[model samples]
Target: MELLVIVGVFFLLCAVFFIRTVSKKKAVDKAVDVDKDDSYAFEAIGALFTAAERSFYGVLTQSLKDNYVLLGKVRVADIIKPQGNLNRSEWQTAFNQISRKHIDFVICDKDNLSILCAIELNDSSHNKADRAQRDAFLSRALSSANIPFVEFTAKRSYVIRDIQNELHQFLAQQSSQTPSADTKICPCCSSQLVERVSKRGKNQGNTFWGCSAYPKCRYVEES
Candidate 1:
């Protein structure tokens, strides 16, 4: 009888201990659930431009306000399109290339926002051969579209008068030369073909009909 009594007491104690442990586990799980709910968050960041880029962007904006609208960090794909006889895979590749590249600034018409010129600020990094090659590629792309392209060395201050004079000269030159209507259109993108002047290698200074959507559409024809 004593043994039976002790066994009953032990079972009761075991049951109580099991219940307490389950209750504690449930409480812990509830606390963890609350923590998870509060965990997701984000914070504010500073300006996207560097000190030099910001200063030049301000100058460029102010200088262009009168005649042209200035757009910063414009994507190459936005201003240009791919046009040519391209298969589906080739078309995708062209679009991917243009999507990866960007122009620093684009000057557009105040009335219609048509791109007038593209500008690249050449910092010390641009002195590297790779950067120079990239710059040359961008220059050719703009030229092929009959859009004026200009490069400026980054500085703390800029002469607005010099910028205005250079733009005037480029606009005047563009007005003299026009893209031929008979040039073939790119199958990938409908943009027209414009004559581009070669700036490097053995074909330096030679003109060719290149798709307006340069890096995006690389179709070229001899002029």
Candidate 2:
């Protein structure tokens, strides 16, 4: 009888402990339910580009119209990757270097959207030691990837023709480096095909690939 009584008391104590433990857990969970009804607040930005950037963007659009696809604030990691046979840690280290950085503008081939070159609108901010260091690293990285990089000063006014001419030079660079038989070349004079805007023709405003030799070669290809 005594053993039975002790056993019953033990069982009763066990049941109470279990109930108390479950209640305490529930109380703790309820107290810590921070996500229940609270909402995170956010606001939309006024604009993505600053005054200088906006001005430059306008110039780029005017100059590049159907010539190239300009993607702004492109993350560097999206364009280039760590090359060849790296261990996990090395790959991660390389990725981390570029993941946080972005190019102000990336020019892509309009047809296939292949990255062509990267451009930066450097204002006074880029003159700092830190900024200069960042610029050098990015220059090296982009060059290593065979992606040409250019910088234009943040000026109150930019010449449209200058931008067009510089961009044309970079676009022609890939084919000019070491022209393979398959590379696009001016068939007439066997010279590098250069991007040119029609100055006086029915397609005056249109851009096209013409021979760098121009008057002498007179070879033109539709771009």
- TM-score: which candidate is best? 2
Segments in model 1 whose C-alpha atoms lie over 4 Å from true places:
1-45, 171-223
Q: Which 10-residue window of candidate 1 scores lowest in summed lDDT?
A: 169-178
Under the 3 Å rule for N, CA and C atoms, how many clashes does model 1 have? 4
| TM-scores of all candidate predictions against the true structure | 0.57, 0.64
Candidate 1 local lDDT, 83-186, one digit each (tens): 67788898788778678788888877554466767888889999999999988888877666556789999986899888778676433322113346664665
Across 18-67, the per-residue lDDT of candidate 2 in tens digits comes to 99999999998987785574675769887888889999999999987564
Residue pairs whose backbone atoms clash in candidate 2: none
Instruction: Give the CA lDDT, 0 to 100, for residue 184 in model 1.
Output: 60
Per-prediction backbone clash count: 4, 0
Candidate 2 lDDT for residue 104: 96
lDDT per prediction? 0.73, 0.79
